[model samples]
Target: MRIALLSYSTKPRGGVVHTLALAEALAALGEDVTVWTLGRGGDEGFFRAVDPAVHLRIVPFPDGPQNEGVGPRIIRSIAVLRDAFDPVAAKYDIVHAQDCISANAVLPSGRCIRTVHHLDQFTTPELAACHERAIVEPDAHVCVSRSVADELARGWGIKAEVIPNGVAYERFADTDPAARRAWKQRLGHYILTVGGIEPRKGSLDLLEAYALLRTKHPDPALVIAGGETLFDYRDYRARWEARAQELGVQPIVLGPVPDDDLPPLVAAADAFAFPSVKEGFGLAAMEALAAGTPLVVRDLPVLREVFADAARFAATPATLAEQLSAALTAADPRRQTAGRRLAAQHTWTEAARRHLDFYRRAGQR
Candidate 1:
């Protein structure tokens, strides 16, 4: 099968990560897979090196004029991506889009499949339109979690197939002890969170929770890593910094960890924190599970659906702190074992087979 997978940016966002991994998995099945993406911020390639089996097409997209609003930038992004993606419709059997921007770009071309990772309410007019169109226009839709698929059905009256994300189980589960020790030496005992300090990530809430957590466990540090984003979060970040100062909490912020360094870093953490306000599959937390790290995630349906009894959950900052403290101090062995088992169950190879089956079904339609 000739499959063309499209993503908005070559960044380290969840959807982009899914696109790269899925493409490689499909290629491993002896299928012809090509990944199409916009190379924002002068990126020559994806954040990490992609497998040689999968073909890559990174479209150059330079920065726009200074002070360009998010709306204009989004419109420009659509135009640029649409202009670059011109695959022969007859050649490719499936053109699957991974995000709203990519879905919008491909919708007009006919019969594109979209994976709705999660539903978001965009304030920007252009982004709002793009999001709605992407949801409504795709020929078929898939969601990583049943909760998100239910949301799609409730809001748009559209039934979407549910196909959960696959994790790089062995990569994290088999992290070298020496490498993990190296990270432990560098960062000390810490509670770690990936995906950066953004609003949707519940950054401010985490700061509040960390502050409370410090009262009980002052020794462990709060470390944040991997925050590469397309939208401007300067205002939200400023507020977060101010609140951190007010709460007298100093968090160690490592901008973006290299691909090779990530597994050990995850393995070294005393506990992993995932307090996102929204999520599809909680992939990062799953990876933390693969590393045998105790996890404390936000109490959301999607997260509950994904993690189940494998993770500790919290709703508010106070509860979040309480949960983090418990996970850090004395994590349950049963939960740790369960988490590892859950992560190991979700393999890229299995996900690839399911995707191929979905493609065949979509083709029949």
Candidate 2:
């Protein structure tokens, strides 16, 4: 089948990573999948980073200032949608939108399906309106987790199919001892947390918890890895660092690492800690499990669904620290083995098969 995967922002974020993985898997299964994106004129390095097997089409826009105002941003987005859809919509059998925000303006024609990563938690009236419109109008909606689906049904009265995110397992199988040793020398015996520095990600809470743990384990460093420039959430990292200093905790913040470097970085961790307030699907935690690193994550519904009995769950950062400490001190070979086995089952190939099945069924309706 010919499919068009539509996304507004195709940066190397979690959602974009998921989209690219699924697209690559679908192409491997002998499907014609083309990714449609807004052409953000850079060195095109990011697009080159994606697997060459998957097809890509960048819809162009007129030249303008580096950063446009809100009004111009909306106008430019509309222009991009028009340009993308004019030539491609009739040729493809299916169009799968990657996010509700992008789907809001593009899916009203009833020619596409939307996958809701999560609802907009922004308090802005315009953002809320856009989210409501997308939630109510999609031909069909797919959610990344059951918790997300439930929230949509409860709050917006929309029933969405739940499909969990999948990982590229083979990437984490091999180890590089030299790389690990270099990272270890830079940040010794550190507790790792991977995600963008944001308030909802619990970066501040992690600092608080690390402070509490420092009295007993004075030298165990905390490493924060992910993109540093979160446009809306830029203050979160500064606030966290200030708090860490005040509490006298050993905190090292390493901004985003490359995709190829992620596996070794995750594997090198003494233990992985995820103190997020919420998640549609905890991809980093899953990666940790595949790397055979012990996990300490928030005891939330979605996390429970993903890790089940394989991970140690804690509700608060203090509890998270305690659980991580215990896991690090007395490593369980059986649990690590079981976690790796479970992680193996959640491969991108399987996720792509499920997505294809859903697309076929949805198209028939």
Segments of candidate 2 deviating more than 4 angstroms: 39-48, 60-82, 228-230
* Tens-place lDDT digits, model 2, residues 251-323: 7777778767788888899889888887888888888888898988889887888788788998887897788
Best by TM-score: 1
TM-score of every candidate relative to the true structure:
0.98, 0.91
Worst 10 residues of 1 by lDDT: 83-92
- Relative to the unseen true structure, what is the C-alpha lDDT of residue 53 in candidate 1, on a scale of 0 to 100? 94
lDDT of each residue in 120-157, candidate 1, tens digit only: 99999999999999999989999999999999999999
Candidate 2 structure, TM-score to reference: 0.91
